[model samples]
Structures are given as structure tokens and as C-alpha cells.
Target: MTVSFRDSIALHANALSLREKRNEILASNIANAATPNFQARDFDFEAELARASGPAASQGSGVDATLGYRVPVNRSLDGNTVELSVEQMEFSENTLRYQTSLAFINRRISGLMTAIKGE
Candidate 1:
């Protein structure tokens, strides 16, 4: 039987893509932290993953409809909502998760290769 890698690997693939997009959003928040009236934006990773696993998986970037503006704990006089510490923590957490997903994908690929080699 011919096994389709897409079926087995699509979730991790989509997760990596979503994580990359999230990284970009988080970076943007950090970059604009000092700008007046700037708002921090983010998305629900779990929601995006669900969309990616659905029939309409190829619609667009998973974040399109899920993008949300963060509510700041402390509002600034300049109206900027990007909190440096919060953004940094989020970015770090996302990065760690991205690395974990990457490792999982790598392990999956290694197992597939071994199976193909009949070893």
C-alpha cells in the first residue's frame, strides 16, 4: 500500500506555517511597541489548527479571520497597546513550541524513512 505523507504529516506542516505567521505578528508588535496608537495583534493557534484540518483547509493563511488585538493591562498615554514584556514572553513561548513541532516532524520523517528502508 502506498502511504500518503500528506495525510500523516499535514497537521505538523500546517502548525509550522501557523507558528511562522504568529512569529511575524509577534515581531511586528515588538517592532511597533514604541509607535503611537499601535495595537498588538495575535491569533488563536488552536482555532487555526482546526481550520487547517477541515475541508476548507486551503482557504488562506489560518490567521485571517482569527486575528485579535490584545487588551493591555496598562494603557499608555500614547495609546500604544504593545507591551514589550508581554510580547517578549509570548514570542519566546511561541518559539519554543515551534521548535517542539519541528522536532516532532523530524522524528516522523525519520520513522518513515526507516520504514521505507525495511530496517
Candidate 2:
């Protein structure tokens, strides 16, 4: 079976995009932690990722609402919605995931080279 570079790259590209967005959202939440009445928001990451990857996931998902949905977190009496600890935790987790994905792709490339060299 011929594996096209386009298809292979799509997987990594989409993952990278998701990581980038996650970082942005986390940063935004941290930035607004002290803002009164600011409600913490989070995108439907899994849904967005599925949509970007292919139509199969989109159709199987059966509804588009989840893909782009951003919901507000329950608010405190002070109206500050940013939870610093949670944001930091999520950010660290995402960074690890991103690094893992990159490593996997690199290993794939290395395997391809080994095959080409008949080693």
C-alpha cells in the first residue's frame, strides 16, 4: 500500500494545530484570571480535532455543535472564572502530548529511511 505524504502530514498537522489552539486557550484563561465577571471558556478540543482530520469523524459525530462549541465554566461570587492550577495542569499535559506526537512522526520518518537503505 502506498502511503501518501499528504495523508501522513495531515495527521501531524492537525495535531499541531490542536496543540497550538490549546495553548492559546490556556494562555487566555490564565491572562483573564483576575478579570471580574470573566467566565472561563474552553473549546470542544476533541470535536475540533475530529472535524479537521476527516469527514468520517464529522459524520460519525452526527452533529456539528460539539465541534466548535465553547462553553462557560460555573462562576464564583467574585466572577473570576480562571482557575490557575487547572490551566497550568492542562497546559503541561498538552505540551507532553504535543512532544509525543512529534516523536512518533520522527520515528516514522526514521523507519522510512531504514527501509530505503535496506537496513
Candidate 3:
């Protein structure tokens, strides 16, 4: 397979993994909403993907070594940082992106099969 196709497949796989992690983090945030002094944690998906794929300096050209950071966006009086609205929004967006990535991977596989069969 060509380098571009291979890269595409790899990227999609990374995306799928990232999406799974994001889902878990979001779920955690939602589940902790009721807990007092709970600090909301978030994953930097873009940064994670960059690191997974390659170094921040070489991010565009290849794999980046930058580790994704999890930060709290807001703090509450009781130290609770989980924001229901924000978590829900991120969850929805991540879900959409995951679906898109899956679709692309499936299409690529289909094309490869067609070519292999000389169809």
C-alpha cells in the first residue's frame, strides 16, 4: 500500500482510540457532577492525537511527542469542576468525529478490496 493510504489508516485508528478515551473522560466528568470538591478533568484530544501520531515541533510533518494535558476549565465553590453542559457538548462532538473517522476507514477498506479484486 502507498504511504498515504497507510498513514490514513493509522490516523483513523489513533482517532478511534482517542475517541474512546475522550468518552471515558467525559463520562467520568458527568458522573462526578454530584460530588462536592470534584475537579473536572478533560483530555486534550488534538494534543493526544499529535503525540500518538508523532513531537509537537514536527507535528505537521510527522509524529509529535507532546503529551496531552488534562485541565480543569472551571472551579466551583465546593471545588467541583464538572460542568454538565460542557461535558455533554464535548461528548456529542466527539461522537460525531468518531463516526466520521469510522466511515472514512470503512470507505478506504472498501476501495482497497475493489482494487485487490481488480473490479
Candidate 4:
């Protein structure tokens, strides 16, 4: 039986990619916090994961149609939607999740190597 690592590790791999993209988006939001009329953008992680593990798997890219603008809780007079507190929180959370996914993939790879070694 042919064992495809892609199939076995798709979830964690895609999740890591998605989390990286999210981190970029959140960082961009923070960078643009002072730019007038700049709308904060983000993507739905669950939806992107679904798409990444679905028909879009062949595309080999993490991005999809899930990106959207964040609604401001308190609209700024400058029309910027990026909230520093919220962006920082999301960035930190995403970083943690990314590290978790990376660790999981590493463990999985190690287990596979052990199995192949028959030790």
C-alpha cells in the first residue's frame, strides 16, 4: 500500500500555512493602523482550512476567497478599522496555534520515520 504523507498530514500542513497567512494579515492591520481609510482585513480560518483541504488542494496555495474586512467596534474619525489591541491579540493567538501545528507535524514525521526504520 502506498502511504501518501500529503493525505495523512494535510490538516496540520494547511493549518500552519493558513496561520502564517493570518499572521501576515494581522501584522498588516497593525502596520496600517495609522493609515487613514485603511480597512482591516482578515480571513476565516475554518473556511480557509476547509477550502485548502478540499478541491483547492491542487492549487498548492494557502489563500482563497475567505478574506474579508473586519468591522470596527468603534469607528475612528480617520476611517481606519485596525484596532491595535485586537490585532495584537489575534497575532499572538495565531502565533501560538502555528507553533502547535508545527510541533504536531514534526511529531507525526518522527513517528513515521520510526515506523519506517522498524526500530
lDDT of each: 0.89, 0.70, 0.75, 0.89
Candidate 3 Cα deviation (angstroms), residue 29: 0.4
Residue 105 CA displacement from its true place in model 1, Å: 0.5
How many Å off is the CA of 2 in candidate 2?
2.1
Estimate candidate 2's alpha-carbon lDDT, on a 0 to 1 scale.
0.70
The TM-score that candidate 3 achieves is: 0.78
Clashes found in each candidate (C-alpha, N, C closer than 3 A): 0, 0, 5, 0
lDDT tens digits by residue: candidate 2, 70-109: 3435556786777778878888888888898788778878
Per-residue lDDT tens digits for candidate 4, residues 14-117, read 89889988998999999999999999999889887888888747746655547899998997999999989999999999999999999999999999999999
Arranged by lDDT, best first: 1, 4, 3, 2
Residue pairs clashing in model 1 are none
Lowest summed-lDDT stretch of 10 residues in model 3? 61-70
- Candidate 1's TM-score reads 0.90
lDDT of 3 by residue, 23-111 (tens): 87788888988899877776677877877776333434543233343455666778787778888998899899999989988998998
Off by over 4 Å in 1: 1-3, 59-65
What's model 4's TM-score? 0.91
